[model samples]
Target: MLDLTKLSQQMQGMSQHINREAEASRKRIEIALNLMEQAKLNSDNLMQKHEEFKQRIIFKPATPLEPLNHYPYIVEPPLAHTVFATDGSQIAPSAHEIAYCYLINVGRVILHYGQSRHPILDSVPEIYYRPEDLYLSRQWGIKTEEWMGYRRSVSEAIILAESGQQLLEISPNQQLNIPTLALVDGSLVYWFLEQLPSEARDLILQPILQSWEQLRLANIPLMGYVSASRSSESLSFLRLQACTFEEPNCLKYCPGTGGMSATGTEKKAPCQVCDPLRDTVLWESQLKPGQRSPFWRSNSSILDLYDHHQIYFCYVNVGMEIARLEVPAWVVENSEQLELALGMVIAQVQKGYGYPVVLAEAHNQAVVKGGDRSRFFAMLEQQMIKAGLRNVGISYKEARKRGSIA
Candidate 1:
């Protein structure tokens, strides 16, 4: 049991620290806003600087597709439109359990607004227990959690693509020619693949890219919605403008405090001007409810693998919080698709009271409660026992955790 007295004492110190940080952040935001205003006037110079330092900057900076201060009012959604969303939950492989296996459950939701069609809601659950599925290699040097996460992401995207294809097929017969939007819960960029081996990366990424292509061919706009996002790519651009150095070379000027190392190593140092500002804070201050900031292209290294399906994003104020909406390059290049995607997103958020209704429903379908996990293991053990399998049991530590006795 936790000691309440001790926790109370620690909480007081934590509160004081947070207060100090908050005060510092308030001052930094003022400076950042001033820099934003300057950036609007000197947008051309910033663009030039971005081109010059594109390769040297360690942090991901957004490439602006519109004016620095452009905030467009949310376009009203079509009276009759369809929205499809998918979310996934996973049960990581545990050594203490009866079996060294994992589970992925993807929940899908489809809602038809301004029409009488019934909503579609369902979940797909798959289990992987094979050695090849559980491990990256025979030696088990690499953990399966990251690989499993990648697989789950692939499943989510594939499901969305399949959903889009199905919608397209039936739309012609059902006369459902209204606009449609597909949404996923988080980022589309597979950042984890950056460290994986090429073979492993391709094996995992190909399916996702194919699914994206399918959606493109189907002419369905897909989006990744991140709520209360803490990404700082936009702020990184501001940091470039706030650089005091004449050349703005991150490596040479902003090396470690002791300057260049003996080995001439390059290291990233935080800019004193905009060290802690986030994209959410910047947009939250700039955009009104139901408004969206100008679009920007992501510079994530993983995006290099995205090819023509490059990811672009914008910040939308959904009343409750600022959300980062990531869409494919194809969707952004087409004005009709872009407007339909954005309008549907804002409408969905409004209907769900600050969250997308389809996403929330999908999350509800995908979530696995603690009791459900316990029951799953119990059923697995029972089935194994029935099959006359020997040595099928949980670890002693797990047993103790399940039932503790003084």
Candidate 2:
């Protein structure tokens, strides 16, 4: 870059001045040698690089990543006797406190479909999620715009992880707690479960699995739910997908330390134009993992964009409808972030259809699984008995198609 020339000139001038000053002072001229040595370092490196560039080894660019198996909307199945579809939303802080929201679609409740807003997982903490720990701002002040954006995004994700965990831990003491399947909206679940530095994954999942043991302790069934919406993170992702190539700055890639060894080469050359935001994005992508992806991962992979986890609610041995759900866009980041519901993901859960016979009441339903557990269960049973034969013993096989879980 032209900047290199300026830096070299400045360094040479300083070296020349140092030598002159040493000679005049009649002091240790050896110190001037050290200065000259430092000044010559870049020059020598550049010369070596120039020579290497003349005969640099050629390697074919990587073929595009073949996506893994095509995905099916795999959701969790309701526990035996009752299927519960639940989703959560949180209002988290964002840039300029303008607020970026996210919605969790949990699982689909086919009954009383359309728009519904009852949180089936009642005991969840309903806490806000953030990715940054104070440690981030402490080490790098807010003056660092890049760090600030990272902090905001990460802090929000962390809030998601914690709050999501609470969502799973809802009830612990119900008798017929029977099996239960939980569904969530959006991508990337398990709170970075797949992300770990080997030892770290084991360290994290160990405790997480233990926590889930609570359900086993209570003899209840529980499964995690997840949903994905590419439209949520950035428009650039969509743009990248729609096109085959983008300018280096437009597509996501970092520069080499010397602007040659770093990654991010299109099928041909890169963009010559300079864009501040794009440059910052490249820098951040280099420093962080998974360039251009909305979700988080430790690996520097291109396919991370589309590769998401699918936690099943039922066993392959047991056929059940799996569902994914969605809430409004505005509710996920700003506003209440708690989406009552614009959409509900529907699918069969494993184990069984849950046989939950709940009616659509004000976007609410009571499913009675023929068991005495919590007052919630009692109320549900009453509702079922009151409903008469029309909805009793309804099979999810039938309901899966009908979209009737309520």
Q: Among these predicted structures, which one has the highest lDDT? A: 1
RMSD of each: 3.1, 24.8
The digit string of per-residue lDDT tens for model 1 on 224-338 reads 9998787888887787777786566766766654355668954336555666678899888999998899999998988889899999999999899999999989999999889
> Model 2, which residues run further than 4 Å from truth?
1-80, 84-88, 94-174, 186-208, 224-406
**Candidate 2 deviation (Cα RMSD):** 24.8
Checking candidate 1 for backbone clashes, the offending pairs are none
| TM accuracy, model 2 | 0.25
TM of each candidate vs. truth = 0.92, 0.25
Clashes of each: 0, 42
